[model samples]
Target: MVSFTELNQQNDTITELSNVLCHLIDERSVCDLKVTCDLFFSYVDQVKEHLDLEERELYQSMLLHSDQNIRNTANKFLSGSGEIKRVFGQYLKRWSKNKELRINDHDQFVKDTREMFQLVFNRIEDEVEHLYPTVRAVQAAMPK
Candidate 1:
C-alpha cells in the first residue's frame, strides 16, 4: 500500500505540472507551441497513470470496505473520476497530434486548456480537502 504522504506528493507534482502545461499553451511561436504540446501530452499521460494507480490501490480497497459509507463515497468518487478521465481523454485526442495548436485555433485551445485546468484543480481540491482525509480515517480505523 502506498503511504498517504507519497500519494499527496504525487498529487502536488501533478498540480505543478498542470500549471506548467496551462502556462505553456500561451507561447506564441510555432516551434515553442509544438514543444509545449508535447509537454502537455506528457502531462496528460502522467495524469492517466496516476488515476490508474489510485483506482487500483485506493478506490478498489475502498469499494470493498466493510463500512457502507466508505464504500458509497468511494463509488461516488470513482464515478466522478470517470467523467474527468473522459474529458482528459477527449482533450488528448484533440490536441496530441502533430497539428500545432497555436496555428490551428489559439483561442479555442486556450479556452479548452483553461477549462481542463479548472476541472482538474477542483478535483484535486476535493481529494485533498475531503476524500483523502476520509480515506485516512477509514484506514486508521481498520484492524491491523
Candidate 2:
C-alpha cells in the first residue's frame, strides 16, 4: 500500500516532468521533439502506475465501503479513468508514430502537448483537492 505522502510526491514528480516536456515542445526542434515524446511516454507510464495503485489500493476499497457516499465518489472517479486512459492512449499513438517529428507536424504537436498538460494538471488538482481527502477520510475511519 502506497502512503499518501508518497502518492503526492509521485504527483509532484509527474507535474514537474510534464512542465519540462511542455517547455521542450515549445522549442520546436526535432531533437527536442524526440525528447518531448520520450518524456511524454514516461509521463504516461507514471500516470498508469499511479492510477493502477489508486484503483487497487484506494478506489477498490472505497467502492466496497459500507458508506454509500464513499462508494459513489469512488465510482465517479473510477468512471473518468477510462476516458483519461483513452485520451492518453491516443496521444501515445500520435507521438509514437513520429519519434522524430516532421516540420509539418510541429503545430499539431504543440497543440496536443498543451492540451495534454492541461488534462494532466486538472486531473492532478482534482485528485489532490477531492479524491485524496476522501480516500484519507475513508482510511482513517477504517478499523486499524
Candidate 3:
C-alpha cells in the first residue's frame, strides 16, 4: 500500500535532491566530482521510482473510479507521466552514457539540467495539485 504520506515524502525527497543538484552544478567543475555524480544519479533514480510507483499504485484508484471526471483526470496524468518519462530518458542519454557523465559542454549541461529539474518540479506540482486530490476523493467515497 502506497500511503499518501509516503508519496508526498518521495516528492519532497526529489525536490530536495533537485535543489541540491542544481546548487551543486553552480560550483563549477562539480560534474566530474564523484559525490556530485552520485547525487545526480540518485536523483534520477528517485524520480523514476516515484513515477513508477504512482502509475503502479496511486493512479489505479483514480482510473477505477466511478466518476468520469476522476477517470479523465487519471488519463491526463498518465499521459503526462509517459511524456515525462520520454523526455527524461532523452535527457539521460544526452548527458550520461554507459552510466557516466559525458560533459562536452559544461554550460549546456547546466542549462539542460536546470530545465530538466524544472520539468520534474512541474510534474510534482501537478500531481500534488490535481491527481492527489482526485485520489483522495476516490478513496473517501469508498466504503472502508
Using lDDT, give the best candidate's number: 3
For residues 48-110, write the lDDT of model 3, one tens digit per residue.
999999899977778887789999999998998899899989998989986678888889999
TM-score of each: 0.86, 0.88, 0.95
Q: How much lDDT does each candidate structure score? A: 0.76, 0.79, 0.90
Instruction: Tell me the alpha-carbon RMSD of every candidate.
Output: 2.3, 2.1, 1.1
Clashes of 3: 0
Give one digit per residue, the lDDT tens place, for model 1 in 1-144: 777787787778778878887667676464255566666666676677767777877887788888899898898878878999999878867755553443367677778888998887887888888788878987888889
Q: How do the residues 34-111 of candidate 2 rate in per-residue lDDT, one tens digit apiece?
A: 565577667877888887778888887898999999899899888777778889878767765544333458778789
Lowest summed lDDT across 10 adjacent residues in model 3 is found at 58-67
Ranking by lDDT: 3, 2, 1
lDDT for 140 (candidate 1): 86
Ranking by TM-score: 3, 2, 1
Runs in model 2 lying further than 4 Å from the true structure: 30-34, 98-104
